[model samples]
Target: MAQRLGALDLLILLPDPELGILRPAPGFRQTLPGGSTWTELLGRCAGGGEFRATIAYPDVQRLSPADVFITPDGAVLMLIGGQPRVRASELAGAAGLVLALLRSEAREDAASASARASGDVTRRATALASSLDRARADLAKNAAALRDALSDAARLNDELRLLNETLEQRVRNEIAERAKAEDALRQAQKMEAIGRLTGGVAHDFNNLLSPIIGSLDMLVRRGVGGEREQRLVDGALQSAERAKILVQRLLAFARRQPLQPGAVDLNQLVRDMAQLIASTMGATVEVRVELPDDLPPVTADANQLEMALLNLAVNARDAMPGGGMLKISAEPEQVIPGKSHRLRAGRYVRLSVSDTGVGMDEATLSRAIEPFFSTKGVGSGTGLGLSMVHGLALQQNGDLAITSREGAGTTVDLWLPVSGAPAGANDGPGNAAEPLRGSGTALLVDDEDLVRMCTAQMLMELGYRVEEANSAEAALRLLDAGLCPDLLVTDHIMPRMSGAQLARLLTSRIQDLPVLIVSGYAEADGVPAGIPRLCKPFRQAELAASIAALMPTTAIRRRKDVRQ
Candidate 1:
């Protein structure tokens, strides 16, 4: 039983009246303290039935009197040392077995009983050892299985963590794409609104500039002053011309300017500009023009395209403060449907200007085509170069694309629609013709008194008798009152009646009457087709050119020769 319980020693005790203390059964020895009696030990564990106590035994090497089990009928079973092998609830069954052994030993004579007890103990110890070995093997197997389960759980946890991270990254990317799309929509809306506002402002500004330019032009052309005075007048005229160009740029940005789209030899244009670009960019910049021999012609405004190229070249020159290469190249591209959002699906010629210079970052590139948005210092730039080029491209049914990265370089692509017609289809009467000298009545109409006055002077200078009206209604009234003019020149935008409305009315009443419509900006819906249009802020020569073209013959006469 001691071997089964894993205890160092076991004892069965009974009270002895002669000793007045508890004594072990015959053939057994007491292992408790010398002074300890059964009465004292029982007193320490009083009031608890079938109880176990941890009694200290200093004289012995054992750390604990492991279990002191009191059996029924005044018999005690005790275990010394080691933890109790059986639970408190199972201690009763162990006590019963111990009590049976004690009873069996007590039934025989002392020597014979001792010999029988020794044999029984040896047999029980052997069986208990075998049971202990089997229990150890089962415990080891269960421990290994638990370790495997823990390892699998850890691996699964790691895989689940990786999946969660991937999902989070994808969500972040989706959010970023949504934000980028929203930003693009907002920018487009802003540009549209700005275009409308600038168009109107440019119209009014051009109206104001016309009289100033016309008067200055008259002064400079007539040579009406001394050399010093002539120089001052020429300077004033130059300044007015500068303002006119500025207004043109504003009109371009608004997409309200008229464009003369013609089949242009893109390769030839670049080659012709090569020397000019080189000179303009200084010797520090090396200019290179790379164009394929068989590059197709593109449809675009030749003059505006030239300006766009020049602006890009100048910008490239400014970017390379130290020096760099400027390359102008052209290539054919075929855009497929649904492949691009900015450009229409068609054949196109891509005119690109590349520069090995300091480039713009994302923030700067986003605003690069916005009017008046410049990176240069104040007063150094008007900030309309890229915007004008962009607007011109749009007006020609084309598109502009810019690619740049900080510290790398920049490339600007102007995509023009491919033209079926050969180049120079609209190059107009080759050389500058002599100014038209007319001798007839010119019915000049305008709402602004100063603009009317300026036009009247320009007409008089061109040797034409002028009849002025404050509005289109007045011009119609003049025609209704039996006044037949040789020609009609009128501003497009007027109160009550537009220039186009007047021209239509007059054309219906009087056939073959030469008409010229002048305006600050192109109002395609308001203007009548087939009538010659001369843009406002024109000099006398420009006015003469329009008249000469509208009535190619020097002598022009009306069907009815009545005068006011």
Candidate 2:
């Protein structure tokens, strides 16, 4: 039968089977179809299972036998001629409506599930982005901290460099200051030595001058006409000669006397000094000489060495108040290395003066070489003995060392540079002694009135024409007035012009004039280079010998007539 569908037809068919399957919809198709199948028409018409039957003939027109049944829910029953009557439900319209409702519900469920999944994906992406930002912030913080640390380290390095430079400058300045201090100390020591020698010479000069002046006063008052007067004058002249000898000794000790350096044998020197040492020590102290046969000669001033040995001998004798042995010996020695003894390295001749007497402690020994330092009581000792020895040792490029203990004894060793040749025998004391002799026109110049007058009187007695001047200016005036003497004897240390200056001026006027300078002070600074020196407080004999030695009769007779 050709059917017509109603709303009841949708109810008789099965609901769409695809309604439970959900899937991702395409971009353009979001909704499904409502009713497109015949099954939908059947479901819309059927309500319950009841139906009615009907039949109709097409050609014959007669009263038809037909039965039609209808159920309460719109089902119908029909009968045919040859078959039993059948029943069926018609629900085409009703089934179609139900299919449309189920399709709409399925589309709504798919849209809801898609919305939930999109929210979950968005949350995961946001969390990942936040973690990346945090990591970048941490890197920036670490970089800034590293830069600040580097800057601080560079500043500290600059400060240390400046500090190092300042320290170096400070060290250099300290070294310069120390060198200056040492130089000043050496100069002070030299001056102190000179002062002590001056004091000793002056004291001895005054004593000798007192007696000579007193004797002259008596002779002048008594008149110069008698043999007795001449004898008294001669006695006074002898005292003056003693004074001159003392001055020469002082100059030798001071190193101002011209040194004639030559090779001198220490062994021979000590042997030659034996008798003098014995005579000076007398019967109290026994003298012994231990001269080595193989001892070498030394290069030094012979006269100065003799005087030094005598001084040491006298000192040794004085040390032994009670009679004791004074032993003098000579040997070869090598100075200990790396030790500062003020002597250079070389073969040396060591001369030792040992005494069995009361010795000295460390404090006393340290000051033994110092000028004016002495253990002897005042008025008994001049204290220049050891000082003179020390000066002589240094002047000769040698050194002196002393070893002693309290109440035991003392040993003084003098080290001198050795020479190649053997020493010659020294002349005996009696054979070497010579009386003073002179005959010439002599000019005596001295700052002190007593020294000038004493020197003049000695020259007159020695058969010389003498002119006296109390100062260098007076001597120059005398020379200008056509008074050309054969010899010019002047004091080295004077108030205005020194003896060296006077000699220069005189020698310029008269080239061949002989000059002899005398002074208690031994400084060679103001003394002429080549002029012969005679120290102050000299004796008549010493003055005569110096005058005669400088101006021999043959030379004097030739120059006596040359005026101005």
Candidate 3:
């Protein structure tokens, strides 16, 4: 019986605490003290004591003072100092009387202890299984989070790459656009230069046309004393003169006219133009001339310079339709040393035309110098006046400046280089000498048949033997074939070879031969510097005067020698 109880105690301490068996103790059939068989009492006491000892003598050696007990007949009980704390005593007594009861109850307790141990083992295994399932669920959640993070990283990388490509493309497009803009700006500047050249030629040719047209109209009205032959001559002259003026205007716009530069006093010129402005603009617009006493003389075409001033005054008049002041002034200034003004250190005569009228803003001012760019309504103005002024200033080695504000009005300043005074007093129009008699042999080359014939007749009337050629090639052939005229007179534009080329060729052959260039446009090619020039539609007297003025004189001969 002791050995069986000892085995039961060892079983309770196993790693699986609930896996054990209990049985009736052998050779102890009679009931012991307290009305219970010895085997039954020993079984109950031993199982409870073993469980209590395990709890009390935990491997760490601290014991709880609580008794663990099992009752006979398969009932569990706890005792406090040998008093029953469970209601299993009545059931144990009813199972059998004394000895029989104790023996039967021992058998039942051993079975109950075995059953209780099995139930505890089953419950523990269930708890371990639930823990494993929870661990698997946590691992799956971690894996899903890691995968999502990787996917997000890949998407962000793609977006960054696309953004980089877009930025690069935009940069390339901006560079191309800037290059196109620069090219367009250059082309606009070239066209503007061409327009100014055109305006200057028209202004000068118009002056020459005034005299010719006036003379022709007079002759036609008088009818040359009314004879049919005289009438035909007058009609022909009048028609030819009108046609010549039209052609001159066209050539001037094309910048092919020949210029005749001379000394001009800007202060005097402004004063003279002021009178005309006063009369034309009427009493409504005041014409004021503010001339500086120390104004320097500029080298330019005097007539053209006067015309430029008159054009500006007229423009100022039109600007102030409600009437305003037209101020023309002249001053002496030094060319400021800078890259903007390509002038060297020298004296300059500043001529200004200002007005108190509606002005221009930045956009209009930028396009102001362009030919045919006008703010005035259609049919109100031709838009060539300001451009002409710009060209004339440039031709005289000067600069033009414009300043304007939207409501503050505008001012135009023309800077001309200073020139030394003439040796003697200037011969005013009436005091000039009569046209000289010229018997020199002259070659006249012009593309226009009427111009050629008219020019030839004028030379003949002036007592010169005149030969005519319609083209530079024909003129060159005549000269090459030993037709040496005393002077070469040629129009600038021709079908083959220009007048300048002919002049250059002739110069090589006869080094001292004088070439007089006649053109409606002053800027035409091959019109050599320092040569005498006559604008078209010139009267017989003007033509004769130019030829005589250019005729080799003692003074000219000396100057030529000095230059050589």
Give the better candidate number (2 or 3) by TM-score.
3
Q: Give all candidates' CA lDDT scores.
A: 0.80, 0.63, 0.62
Better of 1 and 2 by TM-score: 1
Which structure among the candidates has the greatest lDDT? 1
lDDT of 3: 0.62
CA lDDT of 122 in candidate 2?
Answer: 53
Score candidate 1 by TM-score against the native.
0.70
* Candidate 1 runs further than 4 Å off: 1-174, 431-436, 561-564
Query: How would you encode candidate 1's per-residue C-alpha lDDT over 1-564 as one tens digit per residue?
Result: 455546666666776668755677754675656444444666643333455655554343434654665655555666766664543334455445444455544443343445467766555555545544554455445445545655687799999999999999999999999999999999999999999998899899888989999998888888998999999999998998998998899899899887778999998999898999999999899999999999999998899899989999999998999999999998999999999999999999999999999999999999999999999988889999999999999988899999999999899999999998999877877535665676778899889888889999989888888999988888878887777888899888888888999888887777788899988976889676688788878898888777877776556654764332
lDDT by residue (120-227, candidate 3, tens digit) is 555544544554455445544543554465468679989999999999999999999999889768956785567555555565555445445545644654566558
| lDDT per residue (tens digit) for residues 1-564 in model 2 | 111111111112222336632222222123323232223323433544433322123223422222333334343232223332122232222222223333433443454455456655454445434443554455345435544654686689899999999999999999999997787588557756674666566545644563365346445545676887688786776666655544544544555544656788776767877998899998989999988787778988888889889988888888899989999988888766656536777678788999998999978986786655778888766666776776677667888889999888899998888766555433222322343344567888877776676677766776778888888899888877878787788877777788889888888877688888776654657665678776545455566666656664453463643434
For lDDT, candidate 1 versus 3, the one ahead is: 1
Q: How many clashing residue pairs, candidate 2?
A: 57
Q: List candidate 2 stretches off by more than 4 Å.
A: 1-262, 275-288, 300-307, 310-326, 333-341, 344-347, 356-358, 370-384, 419-440, 526-530, 554-564
Clashing pairs in 1: none
Q: What's the TM for model 3?
A: 0.54
- In Å, residue 132's CA in model 2 sits off its true spot by 32
